[model samples]
Target: MKFAIAVFSPAHAPSSRRALLFAQAALAGGHEIVRLFFYQDGVHSASANVVAPQDELDVAGQWRSFITEHQLDAVVCIAAALRRGVLNAEEAQRYQRPAVNLPAPWELSGLGQLHEGAQSADRLMCFGGD
Candidate 1:
């Protein structure tokens, strides 16, 4: 089955970990992931600046590695990312920001990307938020 996963929580949140695990499992099971959309605080997962505690699992790093290794379509909501100070190089330059926390393997897009992903996928699994 093809799936589109939407995450609305930060990397530290349990739901974020669950979402990562779900995606990994799906891929392992030979299921395709059309897209992984990160909205709201979930954009933190795509931030290169995020540094998990030494004792922690570093869910964000795991996400980065997983997405990179599989060449997954990982999209972060631009609006939400901007609102939370998660800026890509282009966005940081446009906004005159000094730093870029979002890197390659993660694209900053709009909600339309999420909608398109959902429309193309057989299932839309949303995690976190309320």
Candidate 2:
């Protein structure tokens, strides 16, 4: 199976973790992940500024490592990321930021990427809330 998962909740949200776990399970079952699209509050997962409490590990960092290690297509909504101050190196330079440290294996893009992912994947999974 191929999956294009859209995660719209924050990293701390249980739904966000559920989405990640689902993806991991899918991959373990030998499925392909066409794309992992983060939108709305979910884009925060792609921000390097995310700081987890001392008692907990950084879920966003885990996500980054997972995606990068798997070499999967991970994308964060450009508009959402920008609004939340998540920028790539080029974006940081363009925005005149001092540094850029957005999550790895994630790219900033428009909704078209999500649409394309849906079309490319066998299933379009939405891990989001109203």
Candidate 3:
């Protein structure tokens, strides 16, 4: 089955890890991922500045590697990311920020991307959120 995943938690959250594992299992099962949308606190997963504690698992790093290796379509919500200070180069420059925390392999887009993903995929799996 093709799936579109929407993650709304931070990388340190358990739901974030579960989302990653689910994606991995789906791919291993020969399923396709239509897209991975990171919203709200989940935008932190796409930030290059995320540094896990020494004793903690680097879920953000794992997410980066997984998405890069799979060449998946990973998107971070623009409004959510901006609200949380997760910025790409262009956005940082546009906003006059001192640094850029978001990098390649992750695209910054509006919530419309998530809507599109859900529309295209056979299933839409959302993780985390109030």
Stretches off by above 4 angstroms in model 3 are none
Q: List the residue pairs that clash in candidate 1.
A: none
Please report, as a residue range, the 10-residue window in candidate 2 with the lowest summed lDDT: 97-106
RMSD of 2: 1.6
**List of clashing residue pairs for candidate 3:** none
Q: Which residue runs of candidate 1 sit more than 4 Å off their true CA positions?
A: none
Tell me how far the alpha carbon of residue 119 in candidate 2 is from the true structure, in angstroms, after superposition: 0.6
* Cα lDDT tens digits for candidate 1, 24-84: 9999999999999999899987889888999999999999999999999999999999989
How many collisions per candidate?
0, 0, 0
Overall local distance difference test of candidate 2: 0.87
**CA RMSD, predictions in order:** 1.0, 1.6, 1.1
Let me know the TM-score candidate 1 reaches against the reference structure.
0.97
